[model samples]
Target: METAEFPAATSATDGWEPTLAAALLGAERAPPAPPGPLADLVAEADPGAALLARLAAEGALHRAGTGLGPEALAPTEPRDAFGPECPPAAATRLYGLLSEGYSARGRVEEWFALAAASGVRPPAWLFQALMLHRDSLPATAPAVVGAELDWLARACGEAPAREAAADGAEAADWAEGSVAERRAAFAAFRARDPEGARAALEPVFRKEKADIREALVHALATGLSPADEPFLEACLDDRAGGVRLAAQHLLPNLAGSRYAARMAARARAALTIESKRRLLGGTTHSLVVTLPEESPELARDGVEVNTWERRGGGARASLLRSILGRAPLEAFAEHPPRLWIELALRSEWADPVFHGLFSAAKRTLDPAWSEAMADITAEAYEGKVTGVRRTNEVLGMWAEALDLLPDAAWEARVGALIRARKIEVVLAVLAQGPEHFSEPFTATLLDWLAFVTRGSDALRRDLAKPWVIARLGDRLFPSEDAAAAAAAILARLPEEDTDRLRTQLTGLTGVLDLRAAIRRDFRSETTTGGMAQG
Candidate 1:
């Protein structure tokens, strides 16, 4: 073979392929037309030179990718498979999930679970593309793609090489790789040894530009702890606002960090809970809100004060709440979380005050505070609380907190909303996501759906019903059961109303039907429990 220089030529990274036979045969036997971008540049060239140019074009085809991209360093034969590709129906659905039905991203997981249960693999035509895009799929995707993927996995350089690279070798990639690569390497280092990652990062840390520095600092969150406090506290003084913000996020989760300690002290000093003897007899408690004095120094702790970057709330109020939000839940050791919950409902700064506790509870996973806030938020929604005005914003705060509650608490709060027909509040339980829904959690959801899909007050009237249904599709278990429920509900609707509502609930009923079809089409002899029953 011969080569030529064609630096000006280009190839479509995805669409182009080599015409190897013409290139290898030489200009005597088979003259080749110039290919890809070379078409215009080499069109007038004599055949031999054109073939040589095609050979040179090969160099540009080599690409830079995650070690997961497909390549082959040696001659090899395709592996033998134990079973055929998934059923035609299953393959068609997988293609849809990856393409058109991409909006319902949650269903991707269900697709894989069904594939795994069916003991089938992706068809050959889609195999290479699936291998290339495996990162976007569930971790189980490779296994679902089956043992046939072993050679491709090796071709991508992801065997021992990928494993070995994840260790100390990763730190060196900081200088050699792209920002995505650097972040991945730094994350690997952090995962392996956070302290060591910090040490390795600190020496070279300031050398990069601000945006890159911010991303590298974000990698510290992998195994965050008080050990990261000093480093992150130092980062709060960074010139980039994003760097300071990233540091602020990691610090709150480390309650023992100096940042947390300083914030807790400032919060206690600002809002003291005072107990006074009542003139009649008993004692009463009141929250004395002495807001903090804001200044430029507050920026060192990620609290914006005098700068143009000060938050929406006034400097003093913002400072107080920022401190309260990051403060450890134990900061107010004297008062039970429930006491603050009730006080917050009646307090003049209800949302602002409770928001701090809610933030702290979520960051720390303090179940006590989460449960209490959820109860009050639901009570306020039920119209049982007279003094406080129940607004969507208030409901939003507790809806988010509901996800953090213990399983029993999560069930109780959601069940309460379902019984009261507070569809809005019930739907708001997806602050984090609709993932992790246990059987009981999904059972509560099904009951709510059964109630709201009937009558004129049905979910059909809610503008967001379809969007909510799509988001909840993967969380609802046992598709056959959900499908049965959905079909029964549709059957119960008046003939005229039935078709219209079904059109609106395409997200709910459609997903259930699709899942049931997948289950039936891909049913395997060895299929067992997990999602197989669905």
Candidate 2:
């Protein structure tokens, strides 16, 4: 009966200290012996057997106090009274010995009767044995198993008793059990009747001293869930901070709820409309204001804004929306882009705001609104502005404006023209520039042309002879001297596009010789590089 068949299962491993203290805990003095006949009967039932029962009992109580409870024994064989191989006659004899010690003077039978009817007494391991060995016991064994669980609910509150049960149960719950099996078992046990479990744990919650409550609560936590939110929430009023904190930690993930909504409402209540308009635009017609006052960290003194303001909002608003708090970007939408931009630069946007901005920007296309978005995107990329996806919107805007410039306007803004057309589009645009390029614009174009021609033979072919001549011809051939200079370059230039660049000094020669034509053609026009041709 005392066989240690499974050493690994029964032996304590390093760091897995048992709840010895709770087990050993008892009233300062021992309880009086069971009334008269029960004590005598226990004394007679093999003194060695009685001692073993007491030892097992003590071990069970210790473990139960630590929040681990024991499993009920099989009814076919009372583990303490008879080993597994005990014959049928021996089982009857063992049952007689157990019944005598438990029910002497009718007290045990009286307790059992009350427990069966009203379900208020403690569980008996002997009853568990009978239930476990149900096939071997009287057909009434189901009633016994049910009664044991009900009794356990009452017993769970008593530290020493609970500790004992916990100890006995720990071996079974953890011994080679799969997580699913353990979860299912605990779920089933707790579900049978939680009111009983609740009552049992209530006493443990209040009375038993030490950190035993930690284990008890953990045991109870396994049974707790969304259904238990009301109970856990009520504990928010607990006198014990640890208990309250535990309840609070479990509240968020269990209940599909959060503190964000409450915080957001509070933030919006404090927010003023003037604040929103100042942050965003005043109306659909007005451009976004980018107001300084809209900044969450705007200084009362109207002091000079620092780089912090220039980069993101200042610290005050940031901390409000950080990990510890909730800062919803939708909360700031009343403001226009400019205001939020100004505010964001001051607050530094922080990480959370960056995510919110990402959400908002993807959904809208307001320019000033989106420009502020650029800052957040840049920040998200860790200050690098290289990748296409990150730059897509901004680059797309620059691209659209280029395709619509008029000839006169394109001629006036050379830099703007460079931006509009691909290098291939430049010659076409130049031809439409009033048959003449401005001396300044022409000079800039010449620099660009020189750069391209020298860059590669592939580019030279791309800038075909006919195309280059058409672009520069009108300006160069206005007079005989200019025409001859252009012709001399043409003669030296490669006749075909496929010639080796080094073999055909054509493109380079054409660019160098154009200088004289430039000077000759513009001689009469106030002495600048070139003039408009009629």
Candidate 3:
């Protein structure tokens, strides 16, 4: 074996190279000699150990000696830079909020919106941090921070040449890009031109990887229409099982499409409404469903042949229920929604029938059916209906249906859920409902939240506190009475006890105070058309 020779020394500090190399290889293989100024310090020291110390001291000198002079900053157009820097206090608060964690995402969005509306940029020192953690920010963050990000990108020589050219590159990249990028590009294209987006994707639909194809097909959900039906229907026979399932999920949304029409016809044929005379006096309507055997058309429309085998027993009956769920609501046009609810409740396939009607209502955007389903769900949740358990499953199903109702209709239900100590259900309902709660609703909810927090046990209060604070900060805290609300909440704190609950209340108070300051600063900036130094 040959010993490798070092490259020629290129600088005055190169004398230390062999000692460093010898230290790396260990003294057993290569002994080191005292080098330069270290000779006086370690002249009598063991050769190997001396060399290691010398390497450390000399490395420090080398770094200190090689510092480069500052380079000139590239020029940026005045128009390209953001209008003004954020107020110093607001910027400091943003840093504190971000340092906390992702729990602050909603608060950060609020700050970003305020900054963007106030025509101010974040502090320059914070740009790199924000860019590094950009993924933590919401999708809408980019638009809010667009000018600042664009300015930084240009400064770092990472900006695209032109917006139009960037878009073209994006379109081209989508063909060969990763799954997420492809989905994003496909969505963007669909939003602009749904038909064109579908046409562009069809040629390569079969050739793409299975997961990628699934994602790209799923993106059609946004601007879905009859125009995209042919492509979706063809995907039902795709080689990828996930692709077929994705197509199945999306096909139901198109209520008037052929796929829906076929499913509706099947449902109408299977279910017959009949009037039965009671023993005492009144007549009652009942639903009699004749289960249809599995067929090619049924399979193509998303009825699974093996579902019964998988779940064990009642295969044909379950398949019939599935078909009815996906079928168009117009198929039952002759019957009132309440009758359908009653029939589903009376039948053996109650869960499937109930879920199917909810799906149909959501797909059709039928307000009347949505309200009826919400009422049934509420009754089930309250244990007012016999034979129905108020389990998480029931609450979950109710939340799903409740989400589709108008805010005004769901508002009272929210109050009732809170009174019932069903905070999770309330959160789920609000999560799926409109983004902004009305003033009256907010006031009512806040009063209930205060009542719950004051009266409930520690565990229950803890469960509800975060959501209450989050909602207050995200929505209601911006209202004119926010200060009053905060003060009222603070005053409600139990006077005798000081613990985690008090700390939480105090923290919420701080957030409210900070938000009030931010609002004032934002108002000043808006009136003056520049960042206000508050």
Candidate 4:
């Protein structure tokens, strides 16, 4: 065939294919002839090296001749835009703050709030970084970030258009959107009008995929009402286990709902309290459990009978615990909570009964019962109570109950526990304690820390010291006396132990200093009405 009649390679890169093939197969086996302009370029060059040199020269020429093709038309500006661009100084400060290894990530919300309050939007290039880290931002962030993201989505299509559907036209879009979009739509609908959201989902309930149906059912938890119960009850028999479990979890929160009442009835039937009076002393109570031979009704209510053998008791005990856990706390009104607790503590079914009561206390959030449970837990932790196991599980349950107690009550208990050197109880209290402590409670805690660090080698080595130090940093370092507290802690550090702890103590001091500086800068900026120069 004539050379022109043969197919012309598209570019220098494609033209090198034959030479590369010959080199791989060995030139002696399959020598390649340079084609087209490459033949003239390599005519005087060494044959073995000529092909590669020609390919390189031709590639360079092609690249040099190429120019950026005509630019595509720019995207239209979004009709909706974010507020004013973020202040350049403030943006710089934000970049610096985020780049550092700061332990207090919660402070990012404060920054976002300040930005929003100032009516400033972050730079466009920073939007992707912000989006990736958005979970740390407060829920209110979207009010500020949403418009900016919408602008970004329109310009570059990087983000999903999650703005609430406008008017009625977008409802069709919502139904046809991806799972995340549908969830967002359902949430927005629930917020605006819960009954309407439920109505919208009902028609599509059976038609939705199993996972989607489960998610939609869970959405009922927001703004739940008697109106949602009928639909939820029907969902108890959903083909998906997750959907059924979601229904089971949501029903108990409706204290007076029929589902709760049914659970209460089952619990009462399983166990009865009988009071007995001693001849010379006070009245005592005993529990008489009458487990059902079979309880399909309870099973339908979400009680799972244990198929596996248990050390304490078999399926009967599991059923009792499940029934008691789901039963309304009000169902035990015949006897005071304290009376029931006393009976539960002394009864043969202590573990299951306490488990159920703890569950009930958590669900109801009854202050009195929560306090009583906390005391019971403290007594158990201190080894003052009989038949109460002191495992981590029991301690955890106690801590959970204490979380429901009033802040004042919990703080007081923590102080007393710390003073008594009940390290385990103190740790438990601190683990579940509120983020911010009252001034007096903080002082008491600092005093405990000072005492612990200075007391004994053994005390310093106790695991509680490190736990206290790590957990109390946020609470302590923000106080006005942070520097003084840090000094006190440093002074108490044993001279012999100081070497091992210097790094940790230095970090703590550095954090305190940084927080102090941040506070001062924030105040200065607020007063001056000007951004702090980075």
Highest-TM-score candidate: 1
Please write out the lDDT profile of model 3 over residues 1-534, one tens digit for every residue. Answer: 346565543334344566577676766565444333444455536666666666775566555654321122225656455467766777777777788788777778778878766677777788777766666876556666665666666776675324544666455556767888788877878888888888889887888899999999899997988888889989999888888889999998886888888888888888878988999999878778777887877777678867446577777767776887789888988888877876776577776677667767877778788888888877877787666778877777788888887777777777677777766677667656656667777677667656756764764465444454544455554554665676687787777644555665666566666666666655445475665433
Give per-residue CA lDDT, model 2, range 144-212, as digits (tens): 344343343344433333344455454444212554444344444555555655564564456543344
Kindly report which residue pairs in candidate 1 clash with one another. none
Q: Rank the candidates by TM-score, best first.
A: 1, 4, 3, 2
Which candidate, 1 or 2, has the higher lDDT?
1
lDDT for model 2 comes to: 0.40
Structural RMSD, model 1: 10.9
What is every candidate's alpha-carbon RMSD to the true fold? Answer: 10.9, 34.1, 11.0, 10.9
Model 1 reaches what TM-score against the true structure?
Answer: 0.73
Whole-model Cα lDDT of every candidate shown, in order: 0.68, 0.40, 0.71, 0.68
TM-score of 4: 0.71
TM-score of each: 0.73, 0.24, 0.69, 0.71
Better of 1 and 4 by TM-score: 1
TM-score of 2: 0.24
Model 2 regions lying over 4 Å from their true place: 1-200, 215-224, 254-379, 382-534
Candidate 4: worst-modelled 10 consecutive residues by lDDT: 66-75
Residue 272 alpha-carbon offset, candidate 4, angstroms: 2.0
Please give, for residues 313-382, the per-residue lDDT of candidate 4 as tens digits: 5777787888888899888888877767756776788878888877888888887788788777767756
Q: Report, for all candidates in order, the number of backbone clashes.
A: 0, 50, 0, 0
